[model samples]
Target: MPAPPPHSAGIPASRRAQIGAGLSDSLGVGLGIFPLGIALGVLVVQAGLPWWVSPALAIGVFAGSVELLLVGMLAAATPLVTIAVTVLAVNFRHVFYALSFPITRVRPGLPRAYSVYAMVDEAYATYALMPAEKLSSARMVTGQLAMQLYWVGGGLLGVWVAGALPAPIEGFEFALVALFIVMTLDALRSKREVPSALLAGLAAAVALIAFPQQALLAALIMFTAGLALRYAVTRGAAHA
Candidate 1:
C-alpha cells in the first residue's frame, strides 16, 4: 500500500481524528491500565506529592506497570535505590524492544530517540493493526508519540478525577479486560492462528507459574519457547 497523507503521517486522519482515534482505540488497553493510573494518582495525592511529579513520571517513565510498581514501593517507604532498581527490572523488556527495533531503519537524531522512548506496548499493538508499507519507521515514531500523549493525558486526567471522586471506582476497571477478551475471541474466530495461540498461552502460563516474581524473565522464556515451537513446525512442514 502507498503512504497515507502527509498530515496523516503516523496516523490516518486529521489532527482531531488522530487524537480522537488514539484515545478511542486505546480505551481497551487504557482500561486495562486505567485502574493502575487511578491508583497511582490516589497514592501521589495521599503522599502529598507535587502535581508535577505524576505527569513527570508518566511522561519520563511511560510504562504503566513500572510506574504503578514504583508508587507501591514509595508507599512502603522503600529506598529510592531499591525503587529505581525494581523499576528497571520491571521495564527491562524495553531493552529487548530497543535491540530488536530497526535501529538502521529509523532516521538518526532526536526524533528516533524520542520515538523509542514512546514506543509502548499498546502503540506497538495498534501499529500492528496497520499495514506494513504504511508503517514507515518515521510514521511509527509519530504514531507512538501520539499514543504516549494519550496515555499521559489519561493519567493526568485520572489524577485529578481520582481526587474528586466520591468513592473508589471498584470493579469498573475490568472494562479493558472484557474488551481484550472480545478482541482475542475475534482474532481466534479464524481457526488458522488457534494452534499458535494455544501453544503460546500454555507456554506463558507455565512460565508465569514457574517464575512468579520475574515477570519479564517469564515472558522472555515463554516467547522463546513459542518461537522455537513455530520454527519446528515450519521445518517439519518443509520436510513433509
Candidate 2:
C-alpha cells in the first residue's frame, strides 16, 4: 500500500527553498520602486498635503498608478466620483488576475482576502513568473507578505524623509512620471503587451480630446476593447 500524501507539513526541503527564493524575488522587485516611493514622499510635502496620508494610501490602496494620479487630483480638487472611477478603471486588470493566481489554490479565507488586497502589480508579476512545480501555498504567501512590507516600509520612509528635505528638492515631481515611463517601457517590450498599452494610450489620448470630463472612462473603454481583441486572437490561434 502507498503511504499517505505529503500534506502542507510534508512540503519538501527543496520546496521550502523555493519559497525562500520567491520571497527574495519579491523583495528585489519592491526595491526597484524605492526611488519612486521617495519621490512620492517629496511630492506629498511639496504639494502641501498631509504626509501621513502617503503611508495610509500605500497601506490601503497600494496601487502605484492611482497613487500618482491622486497627487494631481488632490490639488485640482477632483471630485470623489472621478477619483473612484479612475482608480477602478486603472486597476481593472486585478479583477482578471484574481481569477487565476496560484494563491487561490492555497485555499484562502479571511486572511486570504486581506493578502489578496495587498497583491500589487509587482507581486503579481513575480508570482505569475513562479514555476508551477515550485508554487506552494507557503511560498506564495511568503512572497506576498514580503512584497507588502517592502512597499509599506518604503512609502513610510519616504514620507518621513520628505518632511526633512530642503524646499529645492521638492521640485522632482517629474521623477514620478519618469518612473511610470520606465515601467511602461519594460512591460511593453514584449509584442504581446504592446498592443494593450498602445490601445490604452490611444484611448486616453482620444478621451483627452473628445471627452476631457470622462477621460478615465474613455481609456477604460479602450482597455476593454483591447482585451477583447486579445481574447479573439488567442481563440483563433487555439482553433488553428
Candidate 2's residue-wise lDDT over 59-97, tens digit each? 778876677668777767777887887788778888887
Please identify model 2 stretches exceeding 4 Å from their true place: 1-22, 168-170, 184-202, 212-240
Candidate 1: tens digits of C-alpha lDDT, residues 40-134: 56656555565566677888788766665555455557766656665665576677666555544456798677767776777656655565544
In model 1, how large is the Cα lDDT of residue 173?
39
Clashes of each: 0, 0
Q: Scored by CA lDDT, what does every candidate get?
A: 0.63, 0.73
lDDT agreement of model 1 with the native: 0.63
Off by over 4 Å in 1: 1-39, 103-105, 128-131, 166-240
Instruction: State every prediction's TM-score relative to the real structure.
Output: 0.55, 0.73
Point to the candidate with the largest lDDT: 2
